[model samples]
Target: MMTFYNKQTTEQKEFYENLLSSLASLSKLFSSSDTPYLHYRAHEILFCYAFGANNISRGDVSFDATKDGVGIGLKTFLHGNGNTFQKIAEFNSVSDEIRELGSNHNDIAHFIADKRNERLTDTLSITSTKEMLYHVITRNNQSLNIAECRMSFVEKARIKKVTLKKNNIYFKDSLHEYNFSLAKNTLYKKFDISENILHSIDVNIMGNPFQLLENLSVFDTKESTKTMEIILPLYSTSTGDVGRSSGLNQWNASGRERHQDEVYIPIPSWIHNQFPDFFNYKGKTTPSFMVKLPNTDLVPFKVCQSGGKALMSNPNRLLGHWLLRDVLKLQAGQLATRQLLRQKDIDSVLVTKVEGKEYDYELDFLKYGSYEKFEESHKE
Candidate 1:
């Protein structure tokens, strides 16, 4: 087993130990029994805080936090002898496809394996993380165990056998065992504790957490403000796919032969109609602003084309190079199809308005149906 403490300083180890104990003690307020439970979200936040990592949980990608170019997927579950199968992915959106495959174990196994691999690829591309690992926290009533293992893609070629029982399908690659549930449309992977455990911590549950809270005289109740954001779909809404002659395939748009990197994000007319003041523009002049990319580089952006229907980076190719070449890994002159977007589990980019600026925004990728969810949340 790897020693996580060996890589940490004495001070860091002390802080981590204290943090876990405090969390355990505080968890008593919500539990009916004396046993303290660590919530998964709390584990993610505190893990990042203790390790000086950037919390990327909001992105809803495979990983929850990143540090030193490593993307970490945080998992916390009840520890039962340090070995258990925990959920790793969900395919509820494609549940119909899995159901249609029925009892074809090989086909179902291959299909889900491909989907899992696609998400891993998408996570790495979007986060620009050099490596990925699962940082799991397994907890019993009195203690928590930390384990680390490589976050691997399901080896499609190495899928040796697939078995089906009831609504669950089981399969294994050379490195890991996987289970897929048709009932829940979720994927689970076996985490072998004996092979990966790095640290073990004992937490003391407070007998009376209510008394501790009652001793505090003041509490902060103010809620943090939500960022104003908009979702712009990668595919054209009119066609439900990348337009052959426009959108991401704009290189094929007629006139003169265009550069392969001449793509632009399409902005629907309804977006401007609903949020008229979102983009800055005068009567005749085009609107120009700055967009901060995931890599922290700010590039000049402009709304162009008739009725301001396109959002393109100034010098135009910059945005395309990042979106098409870097993130999507599209080849030159290759069209960005809807299938390709779905494979990446991302169909849109969320543009959040930067504070203190009317036009400047930050861009992050979003999963499919995010735009629909965003709109539903804003319904009158």
Candidate 2:
């Protein structure tokens, strides 16, 4: 029942309208048409700004933003007859399994529904959000429409009918309609705009929007800032598996009987060579620094062990407790395996240096194969 549209104040609505108008004014830059187009990232950021919410799009979770314990998935698309099917999920990694299910519509529906539910459950666990909903924006010739609806899990058990036509599979549950594209390996949910539209605002597209940019003097400044970040794999890259005596299973590391919380995130040597100044490490002492968790708590951390290979919480147990127990829902002695990580669709942690008066960093979850993409982007 957590609705973003119903909870917006007049001031917030005004701000949102103004933001959309400003965005619409730049439509001519992309297209000659008067119809306004809103970029998805801009929608996510501006929505968070207007509503005083935290933007979690970079986390790559099911939801893009969170407010009042509610996780919201923001969507923007062209308006069509107050009813449209927008993509909600992609299953490229599991497309083979879906194809193997063949013409068995019931089995395909169940598989897709289960995968969707798993993603939602994992997102909720990581973000600690109580509810999930979709806050959508639909663009027309001269206006933008806003709508909100519950992001419900597909009722797999109650799927009454399913149809397969060409490369698309269509199904209906008690709550909603769904479509799976075999060619694209994607899932889309139908949104009824007429029933859900809470607000509509007219966008007056400026004829000479370039003049507005020309008048701005701030663009002349040369100073720029970029976030320093890196992604570390959860499993050992050399062995291609979660080592029984290392990584998340560090408690099983030989030599000394370990506490249940004895675990550390492995930092590759290349990171130390490339960004030597990123971590404050000198000689033998482990220099402690603060790390902001996704839940907004600042916890002490340090680079320890020979060659600064391990990044761990101050007591070495705090990070493990959160990553292994809380997020992954693993028991005290449960071994964290690479298969388990892949099953959850997360295999790495994104560490971003927090720019402030104090030396600190922030951590977020990244889906599997993200580290390779990050590496490719940084390749010299």
Candidate 3:
């Protein structure tokens, strides 16, 4: 697991200091209530106010607070400890919305640990933890490590896919009804949609959602540049569809062993429509194009612009592929375009084709030894 330093730079210190102050005031106002659920709302409300994210009727989803919305809805987890959480029925909304929202089994949740310090002004840690577990099972007098035996099975269990039935009373409180503070404070004032932190979030925002970061790093500092992974699909206003470009030829490359640490980002035809100059090559050769991405200071990606499509398969592992399919979070033939953007942010892009299934690093590893291999396999 990668760890980020707790120390803040001058700019980070200034921004967080005011953010903590705003949180302090909000905490005080909500602290007056004796209700346990209200305390939870304080966290949800803080997320909304501080970052312009808003919750639905019963805390099912949080949308981007920006004007240009990203269609994805962030999964929210709030409490002193996030080791466990409950999902109750949302009676106010239609059953279908609740079922659809509930069935999405993605582990990408915006987590806020309300770890109370002596003072409310203390800086809070907004972190995400991937749910990983290992266990040993015995069958037919033989011992088996379940994780080593079937890694996919272990991964599937962490996801929640079943519909909520009669006794499904996971969440009983209503965090949505209590409207606390939407106005800005120091922390809220400093919040910007362009920040890289928003890219990983699955929530929806109010306004025009900020353009998704082209790449994501696990660490906030530059020393740990190549470790970031794009866990969420980003929305782009200018390029139209900018993400793990589906329908492009599977990236097939040599030297899989040497390129184990590399990352891959596909560029679809829509990108060509926007930047025709970059991919105007008419030959069969895979050409290279250099261009700057939004909200990141990393070096320009090593792009292979071919057949009106481009992909970033950096040999040094700079841009990792989005592992949506590897985890089975998305199916190949489903109407997955809806899953790409937050529900509210869907209007930002004209939906031309649904994002059908595509290959991931793990699949590439099985077919070829390299995690970055992009060899086009026969489309099933």
Candidate 4:
């Protein structure tokens, strides 16, 4: 087992201290006063922290003329050269690579659509960042490392043109609009123009420019061919009074109206590709992630310690564990959480409405003999 050490070489010490300082700096930026430039402020600050600590490697934390600079292009930054920052994606208690972006070893480059939607902008707030830091820093050998996470939101866009410029595919949503009706808008979207998270557009870390695609799929064009897939029936009004209805006479009876601003998640195809298991043979089986439906459950410190990115990534995985531990009251060392699927249950959920911008989500579950029953059924 690796024990904590108080001593280290000058370079090692610099790397460690740089991260410590970066954390402090980021914390201050997040907790400080609000501003229209909050997005820009946090973005640059995160870049500063990531770039500074990234250079601490190879004995070069001091800003030099070479790879040690954080101001490198986005293309270069993704290439992982002078600096490293944690990429955020929902994950389990352990670390997993959801996707790969340009490594910063080269030049840094990033891209923003002339009209990128903004529903998941508030992700910059410390609520999500804190979880990311806890796992990326505190969990792994307690050492600071490079990482990042995917942000999400809703966007209602009309097809303009499918253009492929600069190796980045951009499906521009002309006149893109977002809903800031309730405070919920603050939960995810935050493009204050007055406050933007984007540090610089067309940022590439190593010449690996961000690929801009016109649509989710090249085949999905202005004429459109694909159908909207509901990953999880958003938790909206119930299926009764304002629930999802089904009837012939009520053909239009599906009264539920999607926010004119369709929900959109900004995870790149690379990162989005990580959750294949969630969709694999999906129509056949749905992952019934277990949640400890305590009337007023806390954010279980164990789960929070893993960080929100981790919490979001494999929600089903951790939810399974919570069932085994909290609900089943399993012993600490007895066993790890078991992955289970609720074929019927998941199928039913397919029609449920999701509660957008939930602090914590609630889902249907089996009351008694659930974990054991699932375990025994899969014994084969």
Candidate 5:
């Protein structure tokens, strides 16, 4: 936690505090903002450390750097931004090597940031200078502050190339024309910019880089992949007209009048690779996939894969029949609340949408589960 302060007299301190208060109040005017440039740079620096690479440099290889000739590409993500780290297929030069590395590290130099008070809360007001704090989380759910950095914006420019550049770390969006850059890092943007700052960072990271990468290898191994359980929460819509199609198509189709809230969840290839049986396997013999909601018995669920993602499809009345009506106890003309997905022994609580908002759900890779025994027990 970084505090805002400086060496100043009483009058100077009062003036500074007043200025900060005014800026905080005025930040509510803007309607939208892009991902902080600090996030991209922090990701790059973390990647360099996670994969045993030191001193960043430009390259045609898949990785940003190397360790003993092994090319190491770094992929990073924020805690709440969701967990689908992607390496654009077109940008990867050494495809095999990249895939090999991704498979080796579960396909990422995965890192997550902790939620902080100074983070941008209002989408309208954009003026902020708080340094981001991050914690590197392992597959075993161990969290340690391995990397923390402060950012400064450099410049913004148009992103002409679709493929990745050597030093280009962040691109705002594929849909946007102009992007922002910080020194070598590049991030694209869809929305129009009005004098947004170009972001840069000063980094402080942990441990011997190689040792951290080596410690993470246990998760990347083939043995770590197994049939595991995952809780997929499905949220209901907030409000609508009497006959309006509440996006809850699954529920409405089953003679229920509930609206659905759509959430885009990233299904990383690593998850598919690890839980191939639950995600990739298609057969009738698979166990009764029951979703344990709050105060409800396990309701039936069907897991399916599309692209590199997995979704719990409720084809029948599994959700509407029991969980929606009984557990949630939702009714017409009322605000539909969110549900939870939990496993047998894990302490983590995963929701369809955090804060009950319409944002994408951040899939935690450390949390996965199996239903073989549960299915057997219910077979009678």
Candidate 6:
């Protein structure tokens, strides 16, 4: 379980409080008896959820992570990417079904209370309780799917340097020590702030808590250095995919160790398409990052560790993610180049490459180890 901090800098904390209050009040305006155009209010509610990530990923860590765990940043993308969200109104093949359902529900709500006397189909239709539950589950599933798509990209990436301190709970591994903060810069690129600001005010406007030095003391913070990392969950994302992406948590654990007192640099993802140069920091080599599939045994698979070495026995077969500028290269001809994908040499045993069937972390986690490792050992 990744825990977040209740403590925060004053400015970061206040900005979050104001932003959250705005989101909540905007949502309630929908349920008002005098609400104008109910459907429009619903859109407003969604907009609040979608474009409001900086707030959710800020302030007290626990509160911040909850919003991020869902796909609340969606409004930002939907708005920026050529109004792709408005397509729900146009009802294209890929977007119509859900929107139609929501629209229909609004019509029903409008009709049942026309100030007249038409309490008619209360016995046969999808009741409000059923509708509410349906919406909850549907939104949750959608959020999960959105996450899969967002993490799918393994383009030019970067690993931010992170430090772990005491009284912080972290997932234990067999090799490297790891810690998580729902706050800024942990799994995202380090933000740039002035030296006077970093030392005196000490906060990240970019919402990257992993870069907060007055609040952090593990990684080396030598003048204006960008030290962050990428997260190594079981999930992987490539281009042009749909639905919830998968992870590799089924066949193995990170097998890394966690420390209660020791300080170590962790990894985060790249914000832009590039990253900073690497140095040989202890534990920066093997603990917090790695690339392994569900099965097909490989050795010396040290993607993240204390040293700056790639350190893999079968580098070609393993699908590890690295800071974009760190290890990936363009092959010249192929239009769709790849990074953080399965290595080239390792034999792929695909009985059938279906969802949760071949190599993903989440399915394996939910079905096997957390459930009991489901195996069909080969007789050959």
Per-model TM values vs. the true structure: 0.82, 0.92, 0.26, 0.19, 0.23, 0.19
Writing each residue's lDDT as its tens digit, candidate 2 over 170-224 gives 9999888999888898899998868888888898888877888798866643443
Q: Candidate 1, 17: how far from true, in Å?
A: 4.1
Candidate 5 local Cα displacement, residue 309, angstroms: 13
Candidate 6 Cα RMSD (Å): 23.9
Supply the TM-score for candidate 2: 0.92
lDDT of each residue in 1-380, candidate 1, tens digit only? 22334566778867877897789877677886555688888887888778777666766478887766777888888778777899999887787788898789899999999989888887787677878888878877787777887689899999977998897899999999999988898999998877677778888888788898889998664643335778888889887888998888888889996788988998887787777666754334375788876644688898888888888999888988888988889999788898988767778888877665433787877877776676676534
**Top model number, TM-score:** 2
User: Candidate 2, residue 112: CA error in Å?
Assistant: 0.9
lDDT of 2 at 343: 78
Go through the candidates in order and give the C-alpha RMSD of each one to the true structure.
3.8, 2.4, 19.5, 22.8, 19.9, 23.9
Better of 1 and 4 by lDDT: 1
- Whole-model Cα lDDT per candidate? 0.80, 0.83, 0.24, 0.24, 0.29, 0.22
TM-score-sorted candidate list, best first = 2, 1, 3, 5, 6, 4
- Tens-digit lDDT track of model 4 for 1-380: 11112222456545544544434333323333211112323333344344332211111011111122111211111221322332211111111111132332111111121112210121112011211111112111112222222223222334334343333222323332222111111111212221212122221121211232223354534542322111222112122111122110111233565221111111112212443432232223233232222222223211121111112213323333443343333343332112111211111111112122222233233212232343344323
lDDT of 3 by residue, 105-164 (tens): 231110000111101111000001122111111111111111111001112223233222
Which lDDT tens digits does candidate 6 get at residues 292-341? 22222222233343233222223422332221111222122211121222
Q: Model 4 reaches what TM-score against the true structure?
A: 0.19
- Lowest-lDDT window of 10 residues in candidate 6? 129-138
Error of 3 at 7 (Å): 6.7
Compute the lDDT of residue 128 as modeled in candidate 3. 14
